[model samples]
Structures are given as C-alpha cells and as structure tokens.
Target: MKTKESKKKRTEIQAVDLFCGVGGLTHGLILGGVKVVAGVDLDSICRFPYEANNAAAFIEQDVKTLSGKTVRKLFSERGLKLLAGCAPCQPFSTYSRGGRKSGINEDWELVASFGRLVREVQPDLVTMENVPQVEQHPVFQEFLSDLHGYHVSWSVVECSSIGVPQTRKRLVLFASKFGPEGLSISESNRRKVTVKDAIAHLRPVVAGQADKKDPLHIAPRLSDLNMKRIKASRPGGTWRDWHPSMRAACHRKVSGDTYPSVYGRMEWNQPGPTMTTQCFGYGNGRFGHPEQDRAITLREAAMLQTFPVGYRFLKKDEKAKFSLLGRLIGNAVPVRLGEVIAETLKSHVAFYASAEKRECA
Candidate 1:
C-alpha cells in the first residue's frame, strides 16, 4: 500500500522531454514513476521507437522553431509541469567543438533556445544534462542566469556511481520552484554495474554474423586487416599489445603511439568507457567484445548505455544500419543516468509535498 501511494504521488509530476532522442531519457523517467507526457525531437526516425517504447507523444519538429506557448499547451492538462532536455551536445562537447566559442554558432543557439523555452513557460521544474565541458562556455552562464526565479543545483555527475555501466561524466542541472534541498542528485548504494553484468547474456556471434533470433544483434563486417588485428587483441588490451606488423600506420607515428584507447577491448569486470556517436565500430573506441572476435554489436552498445535488452532500435522489417544505430544509441542519455535524475525529482516532490501536508495539518 505504501509503494502504491508513493507511485500515485509520483504521477502528480508530469514532464515533456526536449531534444528527446529515441526516448532514452523518457523511458528511464517513466520507469522511475514520472508521468512523461510527450517527447520532442527533430529526428523523424525516432518517432516509431520513441512513441512505441514510451507512452509519450513524439513531437517531430526542430526545437529551435518550437514556441513556448505550444509546449505550455501540451502541459495544460494539469499536473506539476516539468521540462527536461539535454540539448544536442556537439557544440558544447569537448570532443567535437573544434575550438568553437559558445553563443555564436547555430549549434550553440540550441542551448539558448532551451533557455528561451524555460523563461517563456516557467515550468515548475527543469533539468538539463550534457557533457562536462559545457560548463566552461559563456552561454552556460547565461542559461544559469535565466533561472533567477528557481533554485538550481548542478554538478558533474559520475554516472557509474549511480548504477550506469559506463565510465561517463555528465553535467547535470536541476532547478525547482519548490526549494533548494531536493535539487541535488543522489547516487544509488548498489555496487557498480559492469560489462559482464550488462551484456553476458547475449549469445556469441562472430564478426559479420547476424543472430537469427534478434536482427539488431548483428555486428558489422570487419575488413581483412582489422579482422586479424581483433583476433590478436586481448580483452582490455590496447593497440600497444598488437605486434608491430599489425599496427595501423598512424599507431606507429610518434603522437599516435601515445594514444591507446582506440582498437581496445572492454574489461569484463570493469565498467565500459564513455560511449560515442561512432561506438559501433571496433576501432572507434574501447568497443571490441571481450571474448568475441568482433566489434561490440549495436545491441551490446545500447545495453552498455543501460537500455533494456529488448529495446527496439529499428521497426519490424526495417534493416539496421550500423552508422544510424550507433548515433541513436550512443547519443542517447544513458537510461540508468536518466533513472537517477527521475529518482531525484520523485524524492524531491515527496519531501516538499509531505512538508506542505504537515504545515496544513
């Protein structure tokens, strides 16, 4: 009865996800008991998975053009309005910014547009998650300034501490009209989830082989040279372990020799490395399967990101493309990370609602 009561109270908090990519965050929030009303994203390909996996409507329009009143109308059904998003991180991410400054380019404007909607709608609560490098930009300061009416709490979150199976760091921000005490993220007490914990159930498939039972379990075909390289690769080993004859020409270069994460394999007992847009490729990062002589498949990557094993990245009869699936799964906010954020929000609302009840009594 107590669990049922808490779930009912959690339903009082409603949300709309901005820049919602294939509904990863929305799914996690729903799993955490938050009622996610709708998700908005420019990618039409996301529609099937987003709406199919979550009860939320997938709004397929560029957020840069979306009006706040339009969003407010979506929230008019009457619950505590919560606006959530992780603006596409290309402009703010350290890996891809290419020396670009904030508040100047069209990419950076997306973050500004996020701020615009917050100011216009004045939702009761707001949250944003992105790469840690975003904290250095001036536009981030401006976005922070937009929250003058709300108490905001933010920090660089070590995602693995909160049950995510990856060694990823994110800048998480929580703002609320309720008060300051409930705005912080809380890490779970569970032991760190690891690569073995996440994907060991998957049946072994060699490179270029697709599982008959699951289509998305397919690994991309490896080139002849790369095939030999992966065969020689040890679990948790880098290119440095490769015999000099099999090393990439770049790996033999002075600067490249120092860089070792690429062409590496994940350790079974440890958390996986941060996932990236190119995560499907074996040489892209530490993406090789620990014992299998193939790159980690799309299914493995998504699982490492804490998406359910049964997640539908493609529709029935739709062929899976490595590049497209990689981008969608990699760019998604880790489902476990989103779960922690949702848990934080739920606990916050319960505390304040209880306080109000006591005061009224």
Candidate 2:
C-alpha cells in the first residue's frame, strides 16, 4: 500500500514564522506536523513566550531590515522550507475604516518588505494572513505581482467557520512553487464553536478581582458608576436597555445610537466578538462577561483565541500585566486556524509529489 512518492513526501518540512506574535501560528503548525525552527518579531516582550512555548529561536529584528540571505542562512541545513508572514493588520482593520489614511503607512510597507524577502529567498512555500480589507490596497496587489514564480490561492476566511469561537474575518494567502490547483483549504464543515464552549468553565471573578489560583484571571478595576452600569447590562443588549440616568451622554445622541456593540455583554450561545488589542477593557466592543460584572480575564481571552490553557505568555515569576498580556492575546492568530493552514499545505505537497511520480512512470 506504500507508494514511493508518498514515502518521499514524508520528508520533514521546516518553517520560519515572520511577525510571529507570541508563537500562535508556530504552535499550530507544529501540531499539524511542521518543524518550526525559528520565529521573527520586533517586540522584545515576545521573546520569552515564543521561545519558552515552542522551543524555537526568536529573532528580535524588524522584518523590514531583515535580509533574505539572513533568513535563508537560518534554514541552510533544513529540508523543505516554508516562509510565513502575517504583517500587522492595523492599517486595514474595519475599526479604522472611516478615518483610514489614503496613502501607505509603515505597516503597509511591511507587507511589501515581506514580499521582497519572498523574492529573495524563493522558499518552497509561502503563506500570509491579514485583515480582509487588505485585498483592496495596492500594496497587496504589488505583493501578488511579485509572486510570479509561484502558484497562489487566497480567500477571506471567516474565523468562526474554521472552529475559532469568535466572529473574526481575515485574508489568508497560500502560495507554492509546486502549482496552483492543489492549495485550497477545504471548508471545516463542523458545528461553529460558541463562547460557552470556549470559556464558561473558568471560575467566576467579580469586578476588580483575580482568581487566586490563576493570576492571569485578573480583571481591571472598574469605577463605581461603571460597575453599576455593567450590573444593569444584559447579554446581547446595548445601552438602549440602560436607565436614563445610567446612559453615557454620547449614547443619548443620534450619532452614537448606531454603535450598539459597545458596553454590551456577550451571549453565551454565540461566538464572541473579534478580540482586539484592547479586549480586556469592558468598554471595548462586546467584551463584558455574559453574567459577571467585569470584562473577561487575560486567560479567558487567550482560551477564546484557542491557545492551550498551559500556553505560557508570561514567565513563571513574572506578574501578569493587563495591557501587555491583552496585546499579546488579542493580536494573536487563532491557533486552530493555523492548524488548518498547515494541514492544507501538507495535502498540497502530497498531491504534487504523487502527480510527479505518475508523470515519470
């Protein structure tokens, strides 16, 4: 039953993750059977977590300044190579749509810089993930044009459809020197995961308190008035349900009526809202807990992103700092989504290998 091509395809595939924030993608890819040798990011805070969790080297250099030769040298002794770059998505995020700058920002240039490295290294495979709106930018167009040597497949992926317990959408691109037709990720077709499915089991904590057993379960202190407001807030309801005295001045205005997601509690049966850099704050989006009078904790947010409960974001002796931990958890690519990408790539490689063997015979 063993085909020579299938056996050949079993050779190890090694990868380097660019812009690897806290190693979410790296961890998922490893679960999908890729040997991730290293990760690159500019944030010094990520160094400990990235290395500690994945057992991979972390490079603190900015990708814009990173040379392809330097990256290639890192993979000199590896087998098949993969280059994964998930550039920062702030420039194209839906939250900033109305006031979005017309021209390129430093973040946009990082996409181009990632493309330049692809051209330089010409690795066996390449993958990228970012906000879906990025597809509209000329920078994305330029990056695609640079991939003439590889076959590319891209689509806007709905995170919930792929087992993430959040309603987040992102653009994902897969390119390979192998060929075009073999790269699409099949739809997961499973039941969508819900908020209760992800985090309802955690011990409850009140406003401004931490679960004594888990430091990361700490909530930010709330003002007395804010505490009253949260107690009145209903799951899936907006400020419209609040008493006249409790409503913020802006919510009483016509312009603020449309922003209903703010100061709302999540519905346990549905997927949570997209986690953002400020997700730990109760005032940000629908981050308030369905029943508790506080926002979700750092550990709860991480679990929603599909990170393992044991995933170490802070050192053993390090105290959990809200802002830093929030940024890391909120900005992460969900680990389940990364696993999907890796599985797709593995299938693509196997398909091509089988085809090549048939042609030779």
Candidate 3:
C-alpha cells in the first residue's frame, strides 16, 4: 500500500543502480532528473551515504545473490525501466592486469552476474561502466551476449572528456530495446577543469593535520623517507628528479624508471592521476600536493573525483578515516561523469518518445 503510493510520485522513467558504490551514479542520475528508486550494493558501509545523500533505499545484497524478481519488484510496472551498474572493475583494471593484483574469484564472475540479471529482467535501457580492458575479456563478451536483441554501443571514455579533473579511463556500454540507434553520450564540450581550478582555493593544511572546519581536509602523516622524497619532488617530475641515493630500490631496477609517477607530484595545469583506494598516501601514485609538503587531502581527492564540496561521507562530525573514505571516494563514479551519463539518457528517452508520438499522430 505505502509502496504503491510512493511509486506514484516518481517520474515515468525509473532506475535501479547496482553496485551503487556510495551513490555516485545514483546521485548523478537524480541530479539529471531521473528518479532513482533504490540503489543495490553489497557493502554494508555504503548503506548510510547511499541512503542519506540520494534519498533512495540502499539494498545491501551482493549482486550475485540478488534475484531478478527481487529487483523487478522495486520498479514501477508502468514506465521505462533502466538498469545501471559499475561492476567491480579490479579484475580488468590496468593495475590488476599489470600483475600487481586481481580481484577474487567472485569478482571475476560479477560481470556475468550482471548479465544474468539483465537477461532475466529485460529492462528498457541498460548501462554499465568499467575499466576499458573489460571489453577484451571473455566475460565481457558473454555479458554482451545477454543483450542479443537490443541495440548495443560502447566506448572507452576519457574521464577528462567529461570534465573530471582526473586521469582515468572507463568503458561505458549502453543497450536499449528502442531499436537501431542506441543511447550513447559524447564528450561534454564544457571546458576541462584543471588541478588548480579544482583545489587551489582550499586552505592549505600540512602533513598530519586536519582543518578545524573541514575534517575531511586532513592529510596523512608522512614518513621521514617519504617526507624527503616529497620535498625534493617537483610538479610533473618523476623519481628521476630525486638524488640517486634517495630513489627507491624498485626505481633503481631496469624497470625502476617505468612507473615514475610512483613518487611524483601532480602538475597544476593537468588532471591528477587516477584516484585509487590509497589516494591519501603520499607514496601512492602522483598524489603529492603540487607545492605542499603533504599529499592531497581526502577533500581534494573527492574534488578531483568531482564529488561536490561538503558532500557528506560521515555523520555530523563522526570523524574521518583515511582508508575508508579513500576507498569510497576512489571507487565512486565521478559525480560529474554520472551527471553527463544521466543527461544523455534523458535526451535519448525524450527524443524517442517524441518521435513515437509524432509517428502515432
């Protein structure tokens, strides 16, 4: 009764966000005028932020165990149904593919699970985002098989193309039952925002300090060794800038100079390196502040990921933990990118609906 009444208030186009990490994509869809009824993710920690910020229900169920009938119950029986997800990307990430680390057995099958549900539910529109390498995997091929009767399109999207001030690339796939022309978003023509443009205005806080007004603006404590490395580090320069004695053993090897960004600083003019689960650590990637002695704060990282300022990751003054927030903000689909995706979907739906109306008239 209450559920039926609640469904009445939403727009004709409704969506469910699977693997909805901390509501990044859900928030973007809502901002773009799509009525997201609920978000589904396995992480229990995702519940609060996904619900608090998005005004949607967060169902903490692993997609593997989630049933299509369960998901179907959440959507209205009337309107255009949409399914959106960013499957656990670690299995196909460059970092993982380079033999650094790969996800568990379950993660390998998540894409298949996503495909299974799509086969069962048959939504009007389906969208997915993942590391570009996923498109090469047999599982991704199998996932596309699930879209047999629909129009499918995919592209490896540069995050900067969507105005996100970060160096990250993702493969976006769109499938629609609407016929030959499928939904696909082009580059947002908006001027790209730079590192300086994104975070230069925040008050500078040194290593191991948190601002009184913004707890998330805290930077991690640097080690004596890394402290020296950061001091000698120049913006856009690699470990090559460091004195030979100061360079890490890994960098000294034949392959040492290969990953120079390991201890590098972000240039003010360019987008920052891709945010990862450890983005707050100075030694991780090119995360050091351009001129500051410490690494960029969680706030700066979030900003680079295009999460709006004052975006709440914790309860009022609940305190911020670097590891936790790093994973949440790092894994989030940049809010801006999500917005671009949603806006594109809205335009696609409108165009088709109008064309159909004219045909009927």
Candidate 4:
C-alpha cells in the first residue's frame, strides 16, 4: 500500500458507499478527490461493475446487516469516516407499481436501519440520494429527526439542470454534525444537455453492433415486431402517430390513455425521458433513440448518468450483458448529481474544520 502522503495526495477524504449499485455515486465521489473505501450492496450482479469502475472493494451484503464494528473497520486504517448511501428507493419511487402506503412497505424499515448505522458509527458527515417521493415518507422524516444535533439540508433536484442529460429528478440530503444548521446549494442555471448532445457523436451502428473502439457501446437487439415498430417511430413521436396495426394492445385499451409515454421516441433537442431500470426495452418507456433505429444502449445510459466514456464497468472477458448493465446504469444516481452532493459536503467539512481551529486557538 502507498504511504499516507500519497493517499492524502490522491484524495481529499475517504467515504463508504452503502447500497452502492455498480458504483455510479462511488465513481463520482472518486472523481471529486474522495477515496471510496468500500461499496456495499445486496445485488450480486453489481459486484463485477462496481469493483471494476471504482477502485474499491465490493461487499455483496445487505445493508440491514451492516454493523458499526464492520463499518468502523472499513475505515480503521485510514482515519477517515465519511458515510454516503443511496438506499433502495423502490418503495418511494414515483414509478412504483405498488401504490404508496406507509406501514405495509418494509423498505421504510431499511431507512431507519440506515439511520441506526449512522447514529452508531457517527461519521463526520452523511449524504443520501433517492427518489423525490422519499421526502414524503414518514420514515424519511423520522430519519431527519434522528439527526437532531446535526446540520441537515435536503431538496428535490432536477438532474438535467446538473448536466445529467436525462430528465430524472431526485431528492438529495446532506447532514453534518459539526457544520452550520444547513448548507445551501444554488440550483444550476446552465443550459440543459439534451439526448442529442450525449449520443449524437457516435457512429451509427445497427442494433447489436459495437462501436469500433468501445465494445460496451452496443445497443440491444430488437424483435422483428419491435423493429417494424421502431421504423415507424419518429423523434418526439409516439405510437399515436404509428399505423393502427403497430399499436400495442394496452395502447388500444381505454386504460392506456394514462401511459402514453411508452413506445415513444425521444426528441433530439430535448432531454431524454427519465431512465428506468428497463430502459433497454424500447417498449418500456420513451427508450427509443431520437434518430437511431435501436433502443438506448448501456453505454448511452451511462453517459446520461454522467459517467465518462473511458469508465470501465465490466471486464473484456465478462459476458457483460446489456439487460443487467442497463439496470445498473439506469437506476444509478447521475454522477454529476453526486458531485453536487460532494460539493455540499466539502463546503460543510471545510466550514466546520475552520470553526474547530478557531476554537482551539
């Protein structure tokens, strides 16, 4: 291992990523000069990509089982203890197929458990990301209440405003026990990056064809019927514009009126639809390319999440299928958004450390 001097030169601080899925947030923190000591997740499939892209160990264990001792050991050698987590947000996602109800959902319990870990380990700082609906959950409120002595701030943020290139919205929370009552982050006023800005430069390759230099830049294969459907789909157009024969059965039903975004094509100049776990499926959402004939690929989804073109998620020899990779990338917090979280925490850390110095003097 490198000496402390080299390690400190490499990163501003160390963090532990809880519920880390394929390391999107972890990678972002790493890029912002934070050393991620470990990434924890329940999904075994995340191991390959999480470890490959972020120089951190992957612990395929449920966060519910995380112990204070284990968490402290994760940082014992480095004297670093900054905790960051994006818990499983299915229960609070607006896209939840299951309607919202408090007592019935067990996922709410996990958030409290996450709080327990924080209260026990007592990290210098904490950061969390989740769907906007999470703020409405009582458990989330309770978690904030538990941090009574800590400074906490949370907001519903539009990822597109932060250059994510997708119209995803999320709730970001930052807490520091030693800083000001709350850290303020100004909303970005920069022009939104559209789907065209993200993927227009890639050479046009048919479905299943990899880019000459980047093997991971391959789109998924569509079925024969889907191929015919995509041919009829136009940028910013929906199946409503398609021939009658190409309409999905659900689209033909009365209830489908509420779900017109599916089987839809993206507009070139606008931000892409909020990427979901099944973004690889053209019929799942507005996943069809703005002009390309294929659905959005894993590489495109990662780029929309603000991952670099050279970021490696899977090894060359790995099967590295799109279905799983798509889930990892689509469900991830856009790394750019994570950078905003890092910046917020960095400011608070700096402020508190300065305050402590003045007190000692």
Candidate 5:
C-alpha cells in the first residue's frame, strides 16, 4: 500500500521499476508525471539513492521471483499499470558478443525472464532499454516473440540525439496491449549537447581536490606517471604523440593499432565518447577533461548521462566516494532518454484510453 503522501503525489500514472539501477528510468518517469511506487533490484547499493530521490520503496529482490500479485499490490491500482525494466546487459553487450561463446552468462537469460514477468503481470504498457547489440541476440528475439500480442515498436536510438551529452546508442522498445496498431516514437532532431555544455562551470581542481560546491564531482586520484601521461596527451590526441618512453608496451607494437580508444581526450565542441564504467580513468576512451588536468568528475559523468547536476546518488552523511559513485553514474541511462521513452508510451496510452472508453459506451 502507498503512504498517504505517495498516494496523492502519484495520482497520474503508477509504475513499478524492475532492475532499477540507481533509479535512472524511474526518475525519468517521475519527471513525466508517473508515480513510481516501488523499485526492485538485487543490488543493495542502489537502495539509498533510489529511495532518496524518488518517493518509491526500494526492494532488494531478485526479479526471478517477481509476479503479478506482488506487482499489483505495490502499484495499488489496476489502471494502466506500467512495467519498465532494463535487464543487465553485460552479457549481451558488444564487448561480450565479441568474445568466445563458450559458457553461459546468466545475465543473458534475464532478458527473456523479464519478458516472462511482463506476461504474468500483464501491465498495460512496457518499456525496456539495452545496448544496441542486444537487438541481435537470440534471447531478445525470444522476448519479442513472447510479446506478440502487444502493439510493439523498437529502434536503436542515439542517446545524443535525445539530449544526452555522451555519444551512446541504446536499443529502446515499447509495447502496449491497448490496440492492434504498432507504436513508434518521433526522433529528436535537435543539435546534440556538447561536452563543454555539460561540465563547463566547475572550478579547476587537480586529481585530489574535491569541488567545494559538490564533493561528489571530484575526479579520481592519479599516479605520478599517469599524471605526466595525461599532460602529454592533448585534447583529441592519442598515445602516438607521447614520447617513446611514455608509450605502453602494447601500444608500441603493430597490433596495438586495434586499441585506438586508449589515451584519448574529448573535443570541447563535440559530444563526449560513451561514458563507460571506467570513464573516471583519464586513459580510458576519450574521457580526459577537454581542458582540466584530471579526468571528468563523477558529477560530470552523470551530467553527460543527462542527469541533473543537483541529482543526489548518495546519502549526505555517507563517505561520498568518487570511484564508486563514478561507476554507478557512468553505467546509468541518461534520464532524458528515459523521459523520451515515457512520453512516447504516454501518447500511446492516451490514444488507447480514448478508444476503450468509446468501445465500452
């Protein structure tokens, strides 16, 4: 049951967030006027932040146990329930797809299982997001097949096109049971937000000094040698510019040409390279600050993900660890992209609601 405040706040639409990692999608739905009542995730690390920002209860439950009864009670309504989730994508990601397919990665099975929950819960609408590579995976194919009765549509949308400052592409899908017509989202054609627009205001702080206004935005500690490596690498330059002594052994060989993303720096005017889990490392991808000495801070990574600057992911009294929070922010969906998904689905729901009422009368 929802608390009195929650019941009033969420009078618009109700949502149950599955696999809610730090509540990125949930935040987007909230911004779109949906009330997210509960979020389920196996990671305890997500609870603090997920609950702090959204008026939702964070349940640390493995989603395999999820069912309609549990979901219905949490939502406290039978009207147009929304089921949203992003199954862990590490297994179906391009990185894993490029590797040998010998052993089974459990995360691969979770995608289809997410489909099972959708069928069982029978929510009025569904939305999912994953790496672009997932669209080609066999498990995703099966999930689509399972959603056969719904009005379904999907595409590999560029995150930057939707106002995310990072150049990340994700496969987004929407399914609704309200009609026979297929659903499609209008693509945003606006100019992409650049790296400078995302992180330009902060005062320069070398590797260790935390920003006084936002400590969570502090960059990671750098080694003395790596510090020199970053200084040698100009914006948009690679290790090729480094003196012979500074080159890593792998980069010195002909085969090293394959690993071009290493020791790169961002172009101030363009969208940033995708913010991966290791984006806090200056040597990883084009993650170096365009002008600052250190790598982009945790706050900057989240901003590039299109998360608001004041978005809080940790308790005020917590240690405010940089590397740990960087990992979380880097991996989250750009909240704006999530909002796009919600808005698209909302239009579809409105159309169906009108149709259903006409049919009943």
Candidate 6:
C-alpha cells in the first residue's frame, strides 16, 4: 500500500511536531538526530519553553486552522519530510469515561484533521501518540483507513517497558510511505528506573517550604489536618492505613472506599504513579512523597517525566506557579518515550535506504 515516492532513498529526516506541549517529543527527536523544523501548538504560553529548549520555530496556530501547504513550506527540500501529531488524548482517556467530560467534539475532530493533512501533504513519515482508549474511537479507525498509501504500525506502549520510571501506557503509531516491515519500537533491555533513581539526590525541603537553592523545589502548604494524615501515612499506603480519627468523612462512606489510591504516598523502590495535571496537590492521586510530609515538588514531577534535571520550564525572573508548571509537566509526553519513537523511525529509514542502494547496484 506504500506510495511509489516511498521507494526513493533519503539522506536525512526533518520533522514538525503538532500540538507540541513543551517540546518533549521535539527534544527526543533532536536527540535521535532529526532536524525538527517547527513545532505547532495553540498555546501561546508554550512558546517560551518550546523555543528556548529546541532550535525550532514555535508556530502558535491551531492544527484545525493549519493547512497542509503551510506545513510543507516548513520542510527542508532535501530530506524525508516527517509529521508528528499527538492530538489531545482526553477525548479517549480512561479517566474521561463515566461522564467525567474532560474532552469535546473539537478534540475528536482534531484526529480527523491530522489524517487530512497526512493525505494532503503526503509526508514520507508520520508519528502519533495518544491514550490507549483512542484505539476504540471511530476517529482512530478513520485515521487508520486514511493511510492507504502509507505503511502504518501502531500498538499500546508500556512506559516502563521502555525505561521510563512511570507506569503510563500510551498508544503510539508510526507510519511511512515506505513498506511497513520494520516500524515497531523494540522494548529496552535496561533495568526499570525507580523513583529513588530519579529524585533521591535533590536537596530536601519540607511542606510549605522551597529549597533555598532550587526555585522549583517548592512544595505546597498542607492544612494542619492533612499534615497529620501524611505523618501517619506510609509509602504505598492509603488513607485506610490512617488511625480512625484521621479518616475523612467521605472515606467512611462505601463509595469512597474504592478510590483508595488517593492521599497515598509513593514507594521509593518502585515507579511512581501516573503524574496527572494536579500532581502538585497532595490530595490528587498518590502524589505524596514517600517519606516527606509533602507532595513532590514541580521539579520532582518533571524529573519523573524524564526531563533533564536542568531543563528550564520557566524563563529567568518568572515565578514558578504550581498549576501552570504542573499542567506543563503532566500533559507532556515523557521525554524517554519520545526518544524511543525517534530511534525506531531512524532505524526504519536506515533499513529502507540500504535496501534501495542494493537495488541500484
């Protein structure tokens, strides 16, 4: 089903990341040797970090309003053009089920729009990463059907299987105008990274306090009652482990018993829980520190997402607001997983280029 254009060999690869939140995918691709020409997103706040960290132009335009012609203009004429689109995954996330209503129709429409650009631009390669629930949506099926001229490969990727220190699972797709024989990312053989491996060396700060040295290491202030609860809480233990007087009124109700992952501390030797948008809040999921009487800091959350320790999420003189930085870190694709995808695409291109050379001889 690959197009005839796929048969040609390329000397390099160039890409543009769509819905690129904070440049996690762009950084990974750059580390894998791809020249990312531009990153497109609607959020203006992302401009500073995306442009500051990566050498690509940040196009602050909605993907729905973007045209294939506009995207093609950004590509270098000499390389294999690639498109990477990771539309907002809330529309199909497991957390969005049961009338949670985190997504809108526009979100679903973005996937179809991504497919439209692929058909119109006819890029040599494409990659998309989203929640696994997206696989069950009609938009996903429609997206797959649109790939008639491209070789496509997709699967649910376990983040821990690829050396990420979290248990996040995502649906990843890789497609090429070349044949589909070699598109899957192989599992990494490296030992699983643990929470201790990530944040153990940071200078310690207590609840309601920031490390004097690192601005991002500030923890949220806990209420007196909440502070007492955390004191009684053990790693991997929930509110159920607390003394009877410390139990919340909701926990006494039968319905609240099922939400045991809340108000729990992370285990040091194990990977941390999935970092969500409210990861900076102690009451959100199991976000409490294993030993400390506070939730992990913004910097700790970013590190758990596999960002480099010194990666700057804010500019000089900018204040580190918890909600702003938390959303940025939580919504980002883990940098390590992005690297895995980039490496897979690089190898796939190499295999086909070698095959084409043998045919020419």
Q: Model 1: per-residue lDDT, tens digit, 11-58? A: 378899999988889988888877899999877778888988889899
Q: What is the lDDT of candidate 2?
A: 0.85
lDDT of each: 0.85, 0.85, 0.84, 0.78, 0.77, 0.85
> How well does each candidate superpose onto the true structure, as a TM-score?
0.93, 0.93, 0.91, 0.88, 0.89, 0.93
Pairwise lDDT winner, candidates 1 and 4: 1
* lDDT digits (tens) for residues 1-361 of candidate 6: 3344654437478999988878888888888888899999877778898999899999998788899999999996777999996888574432233244555666787788889889888999999998898899899999998787788899998898887788899999999988887798887767889999989999889988888767888899999999999999999998999998998898999999899989999999988888888898988889999898899999999888988888888888677899878877888888888888888998899888878778877
Candidate 5: clashing pairs of residues: none
Q: In model 6, which regions exceed 4 Å deviation?
A: 1-9, 91-103
Candidate 5: Cα lDDT at 203: 72
Give the TM-score comparing model 3 with the true structure, all chains together. Answer: 0.91
Q: Which lDDT tens digits does candidate 5 get at residues 58-127?
A: 9987787777678878866534688888877684332233334523456677787788888788887788
Give, for candidate 6, the lowest lDDT window spanning 10 residues.
Answer: 91-100
The residue pairs that clash in candidate 1, if any, are none
> What is candidate 3's lDDT per residue for 1-361, written digit by digit as tens?
2354433332256899998978988988888877899999877777887888887899988788999999899997777899998888574432233334456555668889899999989998898988898887789999999999988998988988788899789888888887545377787767777899999999999899998999999999998999999999999998898898898888878987678799889999988889888899888889999999999999999999888787778888688899888988888888887888888777777777657657866
Cα distance off (Å), candidate 4, residue 134: 1.6
- Write model 2 residue lDDT over 257-337, tens digit each, in one string: 888989889999999999987889988889999998998889889988999888888777678888778888888889988
Q: How many backbone collisions does model 5 have?
A: 0
Residue 231 CA displacement from its true place in model 1, Å: 1.5
* Candidate that beats the other on TM-score, 5 or 6, i.e. the better one: 6
Candidate RMSDs in Å, in order, are: 3.6, 3.6, 4.4, 4.5, 4.8, 4.3
Where is model 1 poorest over a 10-residue stretch in terms of lDDT? 91-100
Q: Residue-wise lDDT of candidate 4 within 272-359, one digit each (tens)?
A: 9888778877899898988788987778878877888777877775555776677677778788877777776666666655565577
| Candidate 3 backbone collisions, by pair | none
